[model samples]
Target: MAAQFATEAGDEPMNNALWRYALQVYSRPGVESLLLRLQDEFDADILQILAVLWANETALRISDEALNAPDYLAWRESMIQPLRDRRRACQRGEHGDLYELLKKAELEAERYGLGLLWTVLKDSPAASENCGLQGLMLLCNSEKECRELLQLAQP
Candidate 1:
């Protein structure tokens, strides 16, 4: 996230929007409530981290039936109003997490002394299009973040 991961080793700036959007999506209707109840800062950095976890987790839940429903896609779109870009990037590709992609990407980056590499993950990017498990990651994240999101849904 922009806050936590915002700074590189030298401490430069990155896209705060990604972090902000991350929280917006990460919080969702119920999750945000939990974070708020705990008095957590609604900043972008933490939110982005949460969003990343949420997006990755949700992408893993889609099934063939869910893939064919328009209404389902719409609902998913609604909940994930923010974090759309990162969510899409994570989602794109095949149906499996290709360790090869991650390895290749990371390797490619390191080739230039970039010292950075992100393995290409095989994802269908299905969630970006507005279908599949809507806000499905509404359940996954660090245990603490999960508890907060869960609390947000309290009656």
Candidate 2:
């Protein structure tokens, strides 16, 4: 299911740009660890954070309503979270192959989730250049962590 959506999503300019930005930024030093820490300690939604950051970079606006869209929430809770939980539960030494597969699936689920976010966010143009930053503030609670993400997200 996710593969099918991902294949189609690749054809969309917005999806391609967002996914590329996410992959590039996430591969940077400290980004993966920082995002995981935010998820574990702050209950942050990594996909939402990435989407907001992508919007900011591209000067697109993601509204609060789009951030809390019911379908996106449902997908995250039902698909992404469970895969993340299962992946985290499996010890790499004990179930290395299974763990790797689970991790890949989780990533795909997240990619699909980003596509979902883009569907709504595309319609809302940014009123100002800082709209993405404004949305990020609403999603992130800790100023320090938010700053850290911003620094890492920048090329």
Candidate 3:
């Protein structure tokens, strides 16, 4: 399913660990809807949530400093959100080609943001405790919804 969004080989950002992890997880059934729900209901940053899950999966601990990725935040605010708003606006209209272009641009911007997050988090310490999905709740609004997302990650 996620393959539908795949870019051609040699596209920038495909080599990043976070990008690969995100694609793998997002390809799972039910994962995409749950993620979109998290985004829409909580206004959560999907990349940050993915980063936290990636950290937990790889036994890494996300520090407060790493989470405060100023460059990524600035880029998301300036580039991603406006594109998302415009793309969504097209969803309510008939601008099909424009919508597709905006969607692609939004995804590329997100990939760039993920690279920034990886730079900050790549050196994080290993997790000494099992702070997995529970840790994600801190970045979400509703624990129940987060738990729902967590279930999809479980084997």
Write down the lDDT of every candidate, Cα atoms only. Answer: 0.34, 0.79, 0.77
Candidate 2 residues 31-141, lDDT tens each? Answer: 999988988888988888988887777666677888888989999999999999999999999999999999999989988888788776656665566765567778878
Root mean square deviation (Cα) for candidate 1: 16.8
Q: TM-score: which is higher, 1 or 2?
A: 2
Candidate 2 lDDT (Cα, 0 to 1): 0.79
Question: Of the candidates numbered 1 and 3, which has the greater TM-score value?
Answer: 3
What is candidate 1's lDDT per residue for 1-155, written digit by digit as tens? 42233322442112232233343554477655554443344322223234333334334333333232444234334433333323345534562464445544432322211110011111334344422123323223345654455344322
Q: Where is model 2 more than 4 Å wrong at Cα?
A: 1-10, 13-15
Which residues of candidate 1, in runs, are more than 4 Å off? 1-13, 20-23, 39-45, 48-155
Q: Pick the candidate with the highest lDDT.
A: 2
Model 3: per-residue Cα lDDT over 1-155, one tens digit each = 22222322443443577787788888888988988988998888788888887777777788655766788889889999999998998963578889999999999888888888877776677789766666687678788877777778654
For candidate 3, what is the total of clashing residue pairs? 0
Candidates in order, TM-scores: namely: 0.23, 0.86, 0.86
Local distance difference test, candidate 3: 0.77
Question: RMSD of candidate 3 to the true fold?
Answer: 5.1
Worst 10 residues of 3 by lDDT: 1-10
